[model samples]
Target: MLPMEEKFIYTDEEKERSEQILTELQDTLGQSFLENDLPKLRNHLSRSIAANAIRRNVFGLNPILCALQTAAIAVKDIGLKRDSVLAILLHQSVQDGNLTLEEIDSRFGEGVSKIIHGLIRIRMLYQKTPVIESENFRNLLLSFAEDMRVILIMIADRVNLMRQIRDVENKEAQRSVSEEASYLYAPLAHKLGLYQLKSELEDLSLKYLEHDAYYLIKDKLNATKAARDAYISSFITPVSEHLKAAGLKFHIKGRTKSIHSIWQKMKKQKCGFEGIYDLFAIRIILDSPADKEKMQCWQAYSIVTDMYQPNPKRLRDWLSVPKSNGYECLHITVLGPDKKWVEVQIRTERMDEIAEHGLAAHWRYKGVKAEGGMDDWLASIRAALEAGDNLEVMDQFKSDLYEKEIYVFTPKGDLLKFPKGVTVLDFAYHIHSKIGNQCVGGKINGKNVSFRTELHSGDTVEILTSTTQKPKQEWLNICKSSRAKAKIRLALKETQVKDGLYAKELLERRFKNKKIDIEEATMGHLLRKMGFKEVSEFYKQIAEEKLDPNYIIEEYQKVYNHDHNLNQPKEAESAENFEFENPSTEFLKKNDDVLVIDQNLKGLDFSLAKCCHPIYGDPVFGFVTVSGGIKIHRCDCPNAPEMRKRFGYRIVKARWSGKGTSQYAITLRVIGNDDIGIVSNISNIISKDEKIVMRSINIDSHDGLFSGNLVVLLDDNSKLNMLIKKLRTVKGVKEVVRI
Candidate 1:
């Protein structure tokens, strides 16, 4: 700890305020904690402030002061443990303060330092946007799972920052902060079961995001507070008396809903402020022992129903099996005076704390138990992070975080929760990857169903598996879960590896039989010439029969013959030495860049004929046109025979002596059945090939049939053929041909 003179220069009033906050924090942590390390902790706090002041100008209150206040709030308000509180106080220092990680570790223990490190890394990850933002957010959740304390501190820190956001002067900064709080942090808080923090964050964010609407809702809520309180008093009076008569010790309070929630209700229901119902809720806090908690909750439910007619569908019983986030309560909407619906929540004091403080309260009161506790929730998050790092995994993480969950049961009566719209295959993968890979079908509720059948709440599903069953490439399009897709990809890659090895062995045997003695270096050059990036890719293409073995042998022979001729004597060559069947083809000239006509057509310009769009490797001849310029045409051009008969003397021999290094514009015609996502699927395949550039695509569909035209820029004919082969594999595509 630093000396007293080096401490933060706080005014007398600020010092008093800090002391008061520290005292409250110590009191909440209890006297036993104060006796052990409170003094040392307090010294560390002062030294942190001093270190921060030296490196940066202390703001009006300074982040250190704000952090301490937030830590105190976490303890007294959120019921977090000592480790979490310490993490909150020091989290900012890890990134912004003069203190380093080693210094923090020396001051505090390793556990606190580790949590701080994780928090800093998560914050850094959050700074990335758009491309990898979702991936980073999923990583943030995984970090939270590694240590629940990190998220607890983050929630506390966000709550404090939101409360103080009004002091920020920049409007754009305020908007950015408010949007992040509303879209990311508030939903996270709600998912963690911290209703109080969630509501506060939402309300604060709304105040900044929609200034006019927030003020209107705020004014209306304030105006109706008096009348609403009277109505609540009159409504609960009879129920209170009945509970008293039944000898049930409980506390009933009128809880006014937050302004943001009321506004959300108005918008969602398409109603005005006056038309909104359930603006306030009544919470019944019962005092019951641990053994009688569930029984007492149901008993209270029965009593409430006796006093008023309850809407059966509006009832939710979480006491029997608390929510995955450790929320336990019984909620019911009862018809009250003037046919108004009054929402009532019944829970014990312990349940109330957990509901308000969320995971922090769970850790504080229940400890870290493995079953249906915080540990279990953490394990699920960890499993999701371990699944894979891809767009599919990010989608799964977001679905798990934000989507409504449905609870189902197994044949053994064990309850399981999955995101809504999950299918039987997702369930199988959730059980085990091997089970999912080998799953042939499933029986939902004792009736056979397809693997794509969507699961619903309370459905018991049993996956049928076969030993010979294997995952198909089409399964990637059917499964919705990230784990299933990842496992399938891994299995397919392994199979490809094995097939590639066998193809390589076959190729080597063929080479040995031919006495070619093809070495690895020679093979590398051959594969590169064929536009293959890897030897395995070349072998895989061979094994898939996409490349013909005869073509490979011919190409290898060409290379061998070229090398053999290079060792022999050189031969004189000239354009006039070439022989042709027709005497008129005698004066042909060769050009490295473009075709050159004979001296007879010397002054004539030459251009490729568009009729055939002849490329470098095609057999070609030149024609003297009416404009007196030589025009090149492929031997197979549709007009070649007519031109040959019409003007035989005008034809001139032409050949390309060097390779063309330019992209050629080409058009392809695709016909297929109209299907969803087919265009996007085709686009994905095209964009994935680095050598292929798609210039434009047009599609027309009618009566279940679709025809598409694609204009692309490509290097050579081989790439065009490879692209056509890939496009044929897209679902619903029937035929692909180049026009």
Candidate 2:
């Protein structure tokens, strides 16, 4: 977030300042004995000071100074931990390749490494690119999921740069960083309760953006500084004396309003800076015990109101009831010495810290805290990503989520969103059931983990699959979302049905081979003996190999023998109820004199449909015509749809039962080069096959290509296909298709 270009050179004074910062940091975070012990806090500090000007960021800001200022804010203002501070200090080192994340992980801890990694990634996102797409901005928001501390630290870094940019010379980087601070960092600070820092960021932004207006406001404030100081001093004397009389330990200060606030007031009131009253407020932060915080604040309010007339409409007693964001103060606007309206705020030390520190203060002073912001932060980011491009969207992003959600990425960087508690299996199913069924586990952020690992907000997931892996009943327990559960159920059901079919086929084949005919009721009894209430379950066990097919067959033989006398033969079952190797073979079963599947037909006049000429060996069906004659058509014939729907009552089961004695015409549209003797080659090929005869050859030639409908008489479809294949092999024959 560096703004404007600056020289790489560091002044001697700046080096001393960095060393002083290092000293200050060590006191904040406890000291380390040596260079290699426990984050090596002092050791890293020494290196950072040495490496100050040696490394500069994209905006050419010195890394050492930026880190020092950012870490100072993080520790003093936000109450962050050593890990966060370490990340702030080491982010630039990691970015410049002078340090590795693994080294940080080993030296400090994983927490520090993760924070630095997030900062490094954010830096890389904008390092080479000036134009930030909406997607990248979205990634920036979601990156907080890696570590919300990153967000806090970046705001600190931006503030440091904004303060220094006035001396830098670059115009474009300055404007860019200024606009970001205005729209992005400023609002974020306000949300986090870093009000003082928030004002600083925006006022600096105003300086960069509205240069003339900023200086004008500054000049006015400067001209009245003496009088303003005298007034503030006069206001404080009475409050201080009253608090001291009450035996209260407190300090009071008057703050001049930020330039941005004054500018906004000027715009709203339609007046210049002089006309904008209430330019500053006085804050009375008390050092009160936890139990007496509220009482002491109310007492201070009473003292203030006694000295000056309080405005009833302007009094805000937040101490009675804190805001949802946990702001507690007693604010009063009173008529002061010169009939000027002055705002005064009273709060305890704890309350002030909570107010100044933003998210961390409430979380820390309240109780044990989570490193990541709760679901509200996630919900807000999701809403902003979905909402139109407005910084206010991110500003107000902290809304509670109706349904908790997590966003993940595919190996290819395709983003996917899922509800909270969704697992790796859920993500796989979200992609496809095929992947889900085959998924064994996955690699999250390149670390191999189980399929049951729950996803977080910013996870990069690459699903791992095995060809042999399949959905199991236990998978239902692992599933979170109903969609994944439903998919797993469906896959399991399909596999069961398939297994049942295989078992049924195997049983039928066994029964046929052994010449055993059993009733459906008898098979039901066998299934019950196998501990299955349903016949489908029996077959499932068989397919799963829990119940061997051979064992089931043996049990069947014993049951058959027990039910009937072995000496007497039983009547064979009807072929219609039989299970053949396959349907096509049963229908096309051949015999000595003819193909021998009985159609159970008497003498009926049958003719092939002229629309789709049916040949022998083709799967054909019989449709009785309106005139009582039968029309034999291929199962996939064009006219079959009309025939079946319009005249379904007249249809009958049919198949070829004998060799075709009658020849039928089949046309082949052949396209090829207009080569001499090509026509003779086609005709000769058809004549050489004694079973097929060329009935007609009609060729049309245009521009070296000859196309013709060659009609031939053939009794079998297989023979026709063979002739087509043979003609294709002929030179100059480019295309041949059945018409």
Candidate 3:
């Protein structure tokens, strides 16, 4: 007899059940499953379930094993390889079980284990990080550095969850997952070239995010289904026959616009769903080789457009320059037989496969990453991570991978894609991180603007950079892309740290000039004496010229009442010795003897120009020959040249002596619907005293509408927070906008 079989852990029934799943897969996949793939799938499930069983002892849930089986079945139907199928089977093993890397490798081979490891990395997002949701997502994208397959499987898992979210008992959990599916996964799927998955995820998300709205749209779509189908059929049938007659073998199918899509168009266009033109679409799948696909598709497009009156403006040639996601299709909107607009897409079978599978199939079949041209995309992310703090890394990681992209071009005629609202800083960094770190200014579409200039589509950005000009902490406010923000933040931190060290040395040198030896300890003590907790705090005050080093020496001298015998030389005279001063008498005399006219000057009733912001130290020039006699402006103001040209003889140079003058208030009319705290906040910003002084304050609100105007007195026009930053912070202030 054969040697007695060793004792087995699994019972016969369990073995048979596992075998049954394998048989079902074989029956479904047929010869496509292959012998190697069949053994791999069976063995993968067996080892994975065994590992999950250990986890079940503690957590008491083994749904991961079932999920694996389901995913294997799903993927098998797609004719995926053993590696991808095995990845599906063992994806969650490490997440749920105590399986080590060696255990996985021993059972599933290195390739399979690596994919599983990627899955494990993705799973860690849910557990390892402090942030549970978005941060987890952020970590997931960042961790794709080691292996990207984990992300693909993770997306697949998300798609599966979206499909079966109703099975979840917790409504809140269902909603959360649904929203995540919609917000994160759907867009990611689209980005990865998984068009079908993207569409499904979006449809499922819409179902939950706005159930009532989704259902209403679904009902309307269903009502028009017959008519829409008939129209699509009539439209495609002729085209399909013509293509066939031309010896082109192509498959044609009709598509209805998704509810979410229809709703979006309606919302964006501000019209009813009925107003949507391309509610029905026709997708043509051509049986052409990969190399000839684009040419053939264009030919097909020409033929179809010839038959139907093509809307020239509506044609989208994605085949020429595919989306960042590698989605390649020829799209056109044409007037159909019924005189209504219809959309059409033409692509090859291979293109359709890649579009549906996205990055998953790219690796699953080709054994490489997706070619949506994200090689550099991911490299930038990894670089950002390696060079940045966790927050910066997370920000770059999210924006690069998940943010909405806008395609812009360079002067060299190269296409550069950026996130929506990305600024010139983002473009600079995208070109070279150093350029971004040192970007001072740029020209967008040939007009000089700040680094913070918001980029628009088709604008050619020329980054003006200087190694001497480092990023400022203030750049955090305007740079929208994560990469630029992270680089700016890193540069700012480094600069601040360097400045801190330099400030310490400068302070010590200054203290030495005062005959005081300043050590770190002495500086700390001095800061505490000044109610500051740290020496850097004191240094910052000195650097900003808020705290004078000379004053510190005096304070120290007063506190001790005697000098220490240590013969240390003090630093040179501090900045305070050179006080802020006005123009000298000689300089003032040179400017046409401009003086406060004691006699009513013949043509000079001076009023400051609202736009030019002329302060006391500014080089002022007066323009006479205006309604407001002498319109004082900064000499470099844009309007100065125009005024000087029109009335050159009337222009007069003006200067302010170092004297405090009574403040002159400027009136700013704010026109926004009145709301809570708006008036109070505006008054607070404009008034020094709690009491608001107004020449006239008007208020009007009718039928729940509200708007108002406040006229208040201030010391000078310089203190007018009425329009810029302060007014922007007020609630319901639609426009703090200068009038």
Comparing 1 and 3 on lDDT, the stronger one = 1
Q: Give the winner by lDDT: 2 or 3.
A: 2
Deviating ranges (above 4 Å) for candidate 2: 1-17, 32-55, 58-60, 79-82, 124-145, 236-254, 282-332, 344-739
Clashes (N, CA, C under 3 Å) per candidate: 0, 0, 10
Q: What's the lDDT for all of these models? A: 0.68, 0.72, 0.61
Candidate 3's C-alpha lDDT? 0.61
Q: For residues 1-739, what per-residue lDDT tens digits would candidate 3 score against the true structure?
A: 1123422245576456656765675665465444566565556556644543423212222344345455553454222344555667665556555456787687657866766776664554334222223322333353343554445455677776776565555667778778777756765555444557767788888887788878888999889788877888888889988898877879988888778788888888888776787877889999998778888998899889889999888888878887655767888988998788888889899887655554323322322234333544554433332243221122233324433445555655455656678888889888987888878899876789987788754466788988788777678888787877787778777776787787767767877776775554554444434445445555655565555567677556543442344434656653222111111223222333232422334334566666554545456877765464667777788787887788788777676644453433233446665565555555445433422233333446666555554444343334555335676677766665322
lDDT of model 2 at position 373: 49
TM-score of 1: 0.45
**Positional deviation of 657 in candidate 2, in angstroms?**
12
TM-score for each of the candidates:
0.45, 0.44, 0.42
How many backbone clashes can be found in candidate 1?
A: 0
Question: How close to the true structure is residue 468 of candidate 3, measured as C-alpha lDDT?
Answer: 88
Model 2: per-residue Cα lDDT over 1-739, one tens digit each: 2333533577687778877886787786664223454347557756654555254655666667777888787766665656777778776677777788999899877878887887876665444342332233343354443555677788888898898788677878999989888866766565545667788998999999999999999999899899888988898898899889999999988978888988998998899876665686999999999999998998999999999999898888888988666778888888888877788989988888665455434333333232234424543332332242232223343223313655566766555657778999999999999999999999998899999999976577889999999899999999899999999999999998988899889878877887877677667655543334557656765676655556577667655665665635656654322221011222222212122122676456666666566777888788777787777778888778987898888777777767736566677889999887677677657756767755445577899999877777676888988998999998999999775
Task: Please list all clashing residue pairs in model 3, or write none if there are none.
Answer: 512-569, 512-570, 512-571, 513-570, 513-571, 514-570, 663-715, 664-715, 664-716, 674-706
Pairs clashing in candidate 1? none
Model 1 lDDT tens row, 1-739: 3454655566787678777887787777764252546666667667765554423122234565677778875665456656666777666666766568887677666766777887885665444231222222332354333455566567777788777767666678778778777766775565455667878999999999998989998998788779878889988898889888888889998877888988888899999877665776999999988888898888889999988899898888888877776779898998877677889999998888665454534333322222223333533433332342221122222213323455455665455666668888888888988898888889997899998998865567889998888777898888776777888888788878888988988888887787778755666656544545567767876787655566687667655665557435557543222111111111122322455466433435677676565655667899989888778988988899999998999999886654555565556778998877677677657656767765556567899998867766665667877898999999999999765
